[model samples]
Target: MAGLSTPKQKISALIITYNEMGYIEKCIDSVSFADEIIVVDSYSKDGTYEYLMNHPKVKVIQNPFENFTAQKSFTLKQASNDWILFLDADEVVSKALQMEIVETINNPNACEAYWFYRKFMFKNSTLNFSGWQTDKNHRLFRKSKAQFTDRKIVHETLEVDGKSCILKEKLTHYCYKNYEDYKGKMLRYGQLKAKEDFYKEKHFNYVLMLIKPLWKFFNHYILRLGILDGKKGVTICYLNALGVLERYRELKRLEKKNELAYYLVMP
Candidate 1:
């Protein structure tokens, strides 16, 4: 028999986008159940603007992309309801998760934030391991109790004031479609992280550059049980390790360039 009907609750689904023409429609469709959906676009040159502007169910706010944390924080303030559900342009909300979110928002159970398990997809296959299996992110939270940190240029994290609980359902992440896309994103993220480390005066050591990648591979593939995922797992591990190595390499390049050199008087 079907379970009792879940109580309705007002939820605002917030999405940040930039040139995500391919993924925007599906992402929006998955959260049609939400009370309101707001898209904080970063002024895309592509047709993303045209498509989103036409969607009746979505409200688009074009803003310049400064950083991940700031863009997300701005999106949160646009939400009308106290309950906010944050989603990326390439992520989809499963049917079970939608129901679970509704129920949780209606009946808080003494929690201010809720986390969702994520299953990443690669080459059209659901990657069950390679450190991706255990991935979880805090996406749902009460606006009053949650805040985002601006410490890093990328990989920003959320801080919730009260207790948090994890939901049973999972969210689907379409992280990369092909090798080119993966490589491009890796390079871009590596550069951003390198800049962050450089600005923060983090040490640039040759030994760390060599060993850290190896550690990342072993930690994710061996300790985290990523080997069980086969070729897909190896590929994920390799990319992760490569990302770390490249960051240090980029950091070293920046260090030698010397930011203060621009102000020096040349002979």
Candidate 2:
């Protein structure tokens, strides 16, 4: 007599993309183990949408871009399986991580969500320090037990309703292609942060604007020992500091615009 075999749980891999043609194929390939791959694209002009559409394994959906949380929330609804593996277009799953995910999901007592640490890559180099040393996120979770925090605009956060544990295997995150690419991403994040603050009615502080960036540079470059990474570290620290400055500047601009609008409609 033999014991009954338990069926392995299926997983739906979800990805969000915009102008990610260069990385989407590799990203998709890495998660081939999933039962299905769903991509929510934001009207990419770079043929990324076309590439996804033609892929037999991927189900592509086009949605208007709002915030990171909204875009991810839309993708979550398209999953057919209860177990979801959410990945960014710029990230790739390693073989070990893929195997670990399969094993974890198969267990009857597995946690509701799994956290994956990432190895950051910038310009083909692996970044060891500069505050990126502990980069991690919850990528695998039960769809029913997880939801995106609506208030988070840029750095979207997933709220899991049940237990969670961190996995040992790491995903590789190709963070930036070049200096310009990194700069553009930072600026976009800054603007999004400002928009989030504006909606929350948070006033801009000039003193913090001046102090924060300086502290950011010092924290990452000196306190975090980013100096060991050399020029790449310096560039990252500097750009991130500039992003902090830009966030406050954009917030101030939004405040002024709101004031002008209020004056125009005065009774």
Candidate 3:
């Protein structure tokens, strides 16, 4: 008698996008190995939604703009498969990663969630340091076992209910195209972080505003060995430090506005 063959495990690739016209096509193509590709777009005006809508392999859903965690949570709910491979619009999964994902999900003893390390790219150059060397996130997982945390606004965190393992293959993240793009992204992240802090009732410290950025620069440029990456390293480290300062500044602004509102209500 012939041995019985196990059924192949189906994987759903989930992506959230907002005006990512330039990178959406390539990102979707890279994840073509997935059984289904679900894209939840935030009403993209840059033609990202239209392209994904027309693509036969993609299932596109349009949602209103919200915080990162909320948007991702909405996307997760649309997946038909138990195994989820969450990807960003600017990120690409290599062939090695595709094979590894397939093999891991097929294994009976595989963990509930898997962390994927990333290779950060700035323009055409691959950044080896500047605190990005150890970049990783839990992108592949069993949907029933994981959900994103509710508090974080900018850098969303996944809360896994079961065991997790890190994958060997890396995802390539085309992070920033130019200086202006990088600046805008960092500033927006800072603003969102400030809103999170405000809701958490966290007090802003002037000392932190002054000292944290300096420490950030030192930590990235020196302690993290960003110096080895040359001028690109310096630029990235400096901008990152500025982003920290911007977060505190925005937080302070929120606090001041709140105080003004309270005084206005006082007769």
Candidate 4:
């Protein structure tokens, strides 16, 4: 239901990827209409490199693995155009969104950036009523005018200093391949968040750990009507809640070690 400006300017699509073999073809094919395609890969161990090497419109660059925010900032810097759309390997350009993007690029008036809603896909299902429905990300923008603020480690957000517009089309996102990958990602992301919070002196409480997971489940499943998606909703909610639990557990360990053991036990 969001509205703003019409598409009227040329766009350069940019992506920072790693081990995207399963999804790269679709990602590239979806954005073929872009004026330029720039991919900064994090030395993928998979066949992603071979695929891009054969792609005619794509320009690939090699980079060592870095955190999401830093890698994206570096990728944008490598892109050789002004207007850029930041996309992920597992994300697909929907037909409606593609049309809107073409139109927007052809006739951009007063907006420098555009935000789009994501339709996250779990296996073969899309949860419409989950908290994910409110998940809108700033993806398309004038590269020179947008930058990421260094506030977050896991869900790094961007800060833009220009007029913006909201596109109605949803971007298709394949979040995880299976349950195993989901759990592994949760553990890794929890470690990242815990480290960041540790530096900021964010203390942890047992009650907060227990309550936060429950709140996440309630927020995603009940409040967001994830119940509409049936089993998919349940899986998403449960995994997300578990991830939150892991984050708090890791944070607590950090606090205990740094605050209590380091000064007293170690010394």
Inter-residue clash pairs, candidate 2:
none
Give the deviation of candidate 1 from the true structure as CA RMSD. 3.7
**Count of clashing pairs, candidate 2:** 0
Clashes of each: 0, 0, 0, 10
Which residue window of length 10 is worst by lDDT in model 4?
Answer: 102-111
What's the lDDT for candidate 2?
0.93
Which candidate has the highest lDDT of all?
2
All candidates: CA RMSD (Å): 3.7, 0.9, 1.3, 5.0
Looking at model 3, report the run of 10 residues with the lowest lDDT sum.
Answer: 176-185
lDDT by candidate, in order shown: 0.87, 0.93, 0.92, 0.83
Per-residue alpha-carbon lDDT of model 2 for 1-267, expressed as tens digits? Answer: 999999989999999999997789889999999999999999999999999999999999999999899999999999999999999999999999999999999999999999999998886889899988977899999999999999888899999999999999999999877898789889889999999999998999999899999999999999998898899899999999989889999999999999999999999
Candidate 1 — worst ten consecutive residues by lDDT sum?
258-267
Q: How do the residues 1-267 of candidate 4 rate in per-residue lDDT, one tens digit apiece?
A: 889765446678998778888788888999998889999888888989878978999999988865777788778888777878889888899778899887776772748888988989886677676688789899888877889877776677888898878998989998867898777777777777887788787888889888999999999899988888898888888888888898898998887777776678764
**Model 3 stretches astray by more than 4 angstroms:** none
Tell me the deviation in Å of residue 64 in model 4.
2.7
- What is candidate 3's lDDT per residue for 41-74, written digit by digit as tens? 9998889988998999999999996799999999
| Candidate 4, lDDT over the whole model | 0.83
> How does model 1 score by TM-score?
0.90
TM-score winner, 1 or 2: 2
